[model samples]
Target chain A: MIRRDLVFEIGRTLIAIALALLLGFVIVLLVSEEPFNAFINFVAGPLTTTRRIGNWIEATIPLIFTGLAVCIAFQAGQFNIGAEGQLFFGAVTATIVALTFQLPMYLHVLVALLGAMVGGAIAGAIPGIMKARWGANELVSSLMLNYVFYRLGLYLINYHYRDSSAGAMVSYRLPETSWLQQFWPPTRVHWGLWVALAAILFSYLFLYRTRWGYALRMTGLNKDFAAYAGISVSAVIIYSQVISGAIAGLAGAADVLGLYRRFQWQQLPGYGFDGIIIAILARNHPLGVPIAALFLAYVRSGASIMSRMSDVSAEMVAIIQGIMILLVTAQAFLAKWRHRSVVREAKKHGLNA
Target chain B: MGSTLKGIFSVGFGYSMLRVTTPILFAALGAVVSEKAGAVNIGLEGLMLISGVTGVIVSAWTQSAWLGLLAGLVLAVLFALFMGYFHIKLGTDMVLAGIAMNVIASGGTVFALFVASGDRGISSSLASKVLPTVELPLINKIPVIGPILSGHNVLTYFALLAVVGVWYFLYRTPLGLRLRAVGESPDSADSVGISVSKMRFLALGISGFLAGFGGCHLSMGYVSWFSRDMTAGRGFIGLAASALGGVHPIGTAIASLFFGFADALSNYMQSLSIPSEFVQMIPYLATVAALGVFARRQMSRERKGKKQAGREVA
Candidate 1:
């Protein structure tokens, strides 16, 4: 029965996506010189080249972990939006570790990842603890904290790690040994992709196949009932957010190690917000996160190609995302169709007597 | 240290602080009204961005800053109505819907900018009209305070007026009480024969208009040209200020002014050896700290109230 409901949700989401794309096409027709070419590029340009495909996957790697992060928090009934800032905090510590120490290649990478995860978790725990102890609103607190974290990162890089000759407010180049190795030559797709997949799998197993997972879900579904059933609601809230932050931090560290040579971000990358949408579209199910992340990454990759190859701007994709999120989240939408289907099922089962 | 303090206390610093606070004050006051209507618009950054662009482009084309401001307000109100439709009528989650609108505004504004001016980075090609900076004729002759208060952008005085206006609108009007009731308890508001959705719609409309004014001040008053993400995080900062201010109009003005002071100080310290980045963090740090304290007080107050009630029952 749960499987059937999941299928229904996926079907509904596809319809929403189709409707959004149709709206996007209307805009393309109104604006672009060659609407057909632009639309084709928007849908099909990413997979046409090997490098582009790798870039698309490269873009998807960070989102998978953030999606899982959002999923964990949402499952525990916490709207901790700190994952966006947590990613940056992770990057900061990861960069520091990468540059400060000299070690074996494998050991350096491991230490950096561990440092990033711990940094993110500590930062992420601020809002969680605040909410648990004082009933502070996590949404506002987390949003405010992002700006502070961003400024801290900027200060650290600009002052302590300034490579004065670089002529920008970026850190010094990281050691080559700390880099995540690529599998295929010249294609930039590194081992970080497999690590992200493993994170997704671990998240799925932890959420569905563990006692703590049951407690988390129970807490989300009904806090009062869960508390009555002997669960420590406060502890669960803090614990889930910590785990969420750790996962997001891991993604940030891995992506930076795999893709870039130095820390150059001056602000939040906005992927954490994207993770919220990914989590929602995936129905807050860990197993569904990778597909959602990949789909979003594909849209982004295709949009970039569409903009370069045709007159249409990449924001066409944003229009699709906005319309899809609005329509898919509207609970009253498609209710009549759902009712009709349910009634048909009752008749088919002959339970009306 | 003394020189830094002197620099911060100078009349020029005070003038810049007022100039910087105007936009934040406008948005924070807007948030106060909307939050009192039971929905806090988290997409204020998007609203400000879209309208800031609209305000600039329309002012540029019409050669009238007023028209540009009007266009910006219209776009913002329409967007608010769109949000109300989905959030109120469709039963969508408010946060998700707000987030969607923000993303749309951010992306849509950029796209529109590209189509209108054929530039992704700036609107430097167009000659946009700026809002007039007013010099109080009689008051300009006064001492240091006069210099600090006079010759500000006209919208700064208007923002100050808006505080009184919003206070009147929220506390003195019959509609205000109903809106408050809705925010406090929608069920009770419904029991009293009030239309919750209608009240919310009206509140959001007013909020959008006020927020639009803030966006206009950014493009039309501050610079006369729209750059990409000119609002940056001002909208979010304004929201934070509103939260810290206890969602009251006067309190919101005070909090926004404080943020403006921090922002002005950060800019002032740019010539010094201190990193501007750390100084730039002051407003956000203040927000988190203020909110933390506010939450602690609320918790203690709640406990006290419960204890008093228990004693009465016994």
Candidate 2:
């Protein structure tokens, strides 16, 4: 029965993806004079070059981190949107360490990332604690905090840490030793990929194998039941956000260290918002996050390529994303079919007389 | 410091506060309607963005500000209905669907802007019409009160009217009562023969309509051109305003005025050698703090009530 349910979930996701793509194509056709060329580029352009594949992987790494972050929070049934703020503060903390500390190579990288995680955890904890302790709406507080932290990060970068000679509002160049070591020679793919993959594994194991994980999932399933079962639901909520924030912080550090030379983000990098879509698409499962991230990254890469080669803008991908999210979360989209399949599987396994 | 204090108390500050509050007040009223119906429209941000851009473009094309306003309102309603269809008819989570709408609006507007004017940032090249300002003859000559009250954008007056209008609609009308009843308890509303979904949809439509005015006010009255992200966080701030007001229409208008005052202060403080970033952070920080305090008070009240109930049962 579990197997059949998994299959149906995957099947529903696939159908949703297909419909999203189809709708994307129709939108392109309406906007682009050379609709065929635009559509083809959107569908096939990402696979056209090694460099593009590298770009796709780089994008996928951050999504993986943020996706895992979102999955953890959602699994605890907390609508904490503080990941964006956490990621921003994390990157700022990472940059501070990268610039100020005089540690040796590996230690410098590790310490910077650790600082970032702490920073993000603090940012995440505020809204989490607020929600748990006072019953404040996590969604509004977190959204408000996103702006506060973003402006604070901008202030830190623009006034305090900016390299005067850089001409733009950005931090001093990160030391080469602090950079994530590139594992791929021909492309800029770095060791952050490995960390992201490990995070995926860690998230899955933690969620399914640990006592805290059981408490969290149980709380998410039913708060009354979890409390009756002697779980501290509020503790789970706070820590779920904290864990998510730490992972999101890791993502910010990795993306900065792996992809850029300095802290130059003027606005929220928006990876945090993208993470919400990935988490939903993955059905809040850590194991499914990377696959969903890859799918999003591929479409994003394709959209960018299409924007360059055709009349269609890269923003077209957002339409696809919006459509995909709406369809996937539509509970009744294939409810009857899913129910019938579950019943059939039960009958076949002699679960029902 | 005295100058700063005087500056804040001056007529210019009051006038600009009303100007700034117009959009947020409209959005807050919109939020009040949807929230009262139990279908909170988190997509006000996207709805405003879509309508703001459309108002600019349509006014430019037709050479009539009213036509542009009408077109924008129509699109806002359609998009609201689209969100409604997903949340109400298709069983999608309202918040998630709203987020999706924001994503689509953010990207789709940029795409459309680029296509229309060959510019992705602003519609400066388009000759969009501005809504007229109303000047009260007698009030215009009334010294200190005159400047603050007289030469104001027409929409500013409308926003003030809308607060009272929304209050009346929610408290005085049968449809409004039904909508509130649905939100209060869908099962009870349904048992009473009220169509929960229909009322919710109507609430969403009213929200869209009010938000449409807010959008038009931004492009036509606040600024003469539509720019990328011109609404900024006004939509979310409006949500905060409505929430801070406990989703009451008159209370929301007052809450919006408070935020608008904060915004005006931020703008004013930039001249005082303060770092604009820190000053700008005030409103957002205040929102979080306000929500925390409000929630804390509400929870204590609920807890006390529960204890009293338990004692009664015992």
Candidate 3:
């Protein structure tokens, strides 16, 4: 039975991927005359070079953090849509600490990471507290927080932390002591990948093995039933949010201290939204998040390489991602296919219901 | 200082508020209709975004604002129909589908921009035409209020008319009742021979039409061109207003006006030497505040009901 289920899951994933590719190909054929070249570039461009592989790893690091963050909240039935805002706040907080301290390299990095956690926690807790205390919908609160943090980041970058020499909305460079050590030479990929892996392992353990985790899952599945069984539903919701926020913040810290030389104020990177897609595709499983993140990162990296290699725009990859998401989220189509297959098998066995 | 204060009042902050509210009013009304039919259309943002681009593109190409408005609405309606087919017929999660639609719309517009014009953002500098303001000559001759009400974009007038139109449709019409019945209890509606799915699809289609017009107003009426992600968070803001307004057309109109007033105030304050960043934060801050208030009220009502049940048992 287990083998059958695994096979079915793999089949579903493959089918979805195939459909997405077909749709993307059709779009490309319509738009570009050199469709075959574009298709080849889109599929194989990222695999051809070492530097591109490094870029994939670099992109995957933050996605791993944010994806895991989203997974935790989603599993708890709390859609923490504020990951983008939380990431911004996290990066800013880490930037502040990384700039202020002149400690040892390891200590500086640790402090920056901790600051990111705190920043994310505070930002994440707002919606959680509002939901718990007053019944404010977490979805709206979290989404609104994205705009707030975006403007706040802009304010800080433009006025308070401005590196005037940069000539735009940017901040001062962090001290070298705070910088994360690189994993490979000539590539920007750093130790953040290891940190992300550790986070994934920790999240998996926390969700599947712990008593608290079980209770949190119970609460998520049915608040009324969980309350009847004497679980503190509100507490679990709040805790899940804070943890999710911290993870997202860590992602921001990883980006800033591990990669960027100086803080550039981005309104909000679509990383949070990407994380949402990852969480959904992974079915909110901690172990599945990293895989999904890697897949998405690979697509992004591949698309960039393809853009460089051929006339096809990298934006075509986004179109594919959107179509895939639409198909996956609309499970009715999947259900219909499944129903048809089941009916056909039953007919063959003369066991029609 | 007194003269400045009077100028602030006389400068028609109310008109500015109305101008800002127009797009939101259309969007909030769309949300009300959709929500009343049991389909949560979180894709309002995407619908508006795509419509905005379509309106700008068509207008720029044809040099006709009306053509742009029509194109935007038509595309919006088609998108709504697609969403309805996926969610109502195919049983997709509304929120996820909405998010996907948004991402597709945003990315698609940017891609199309690159294809249409070599620019990655803020469409062709060919100086596209905008919807002209219609001046009511006789009305303009009236007092201060006349100038405030008259000489506005045609879409603005349409938005005002939509408030009453939506209210009447939702309250007085049989179709509206059926839509509400589905929203309240779809199982019951189904048992009574009402096609819950059909009603939902129709509601969503209407929603898409309204949202498309809203987008047209944003691009053709207000700015005359499309910029990347130019709708910003107005669609989401409209959703919030719809919720805060208790999903009623009149209430949503009021809420939209309040939000628009906040937006206009921020813009006005920015002109008075205030930091633009700080000014920009006002609308977002207001959304949070509104949500906080709405949530608190809901909690208190639940608590009160619980207390009443406890007293009755005693």
Off by over 4 Å in 2: A342-353
Position A247, candidate 2: lDDT: 93
Interface RMSD of each: 1.0, 1.1, 1.6
Residue B233, candidate 1: how far off, in angstroms? 0.9
Summarize candidate 2's per-residue lDDT along B79-162 as a digit string, tens digits: 998999999998998889888988888887877877887766688789999999999899899999999988888889999999
RMSD for each model, in Å, please?
1.5, 1.9, 2.8
Which candidate has the top score in TM-score?
A: 1
**Which candidate has the top score in lDDT?**
2
lDDT per residue for candidate 3 within A258-344, as digits (tens), equals 888568856687788899888877878889888899899998888787677776677777777877777776666567666776677
User: Which residue pairs show backbone clashes in model 3?
Assistant: none
Q: Which residue segments of model 3 deviate by more than 4 Å?
A: A1-3, A336-353, B1-7, B10-15, B116-119, B125-128, B271-274, B310-314
lDDT of 3: 0.83
DockQ of each candidate relative to the true complex:
0.81, 0.80, 0.65
Mind giving the per-residue lDDT tens digits that candidate 1 earns over B1-314?
A: 67778999899999999999999998898788889988988777778877899998898889999899999999988887788788999987778877888888878887888888887757878788898999999899899989999998888999999999999989999999999889999999999999999998888788888889998999989887888678888888889989989999988999999999889999878888888888888888888888889999999999999999999999
lDDT of 2 at B300: 98
User: Which ten residues in a row are the worst by lDDT in model 1 chain B?
Assistant: B117-126
TM-score of candidate 3 to 2 decimals: 0.93
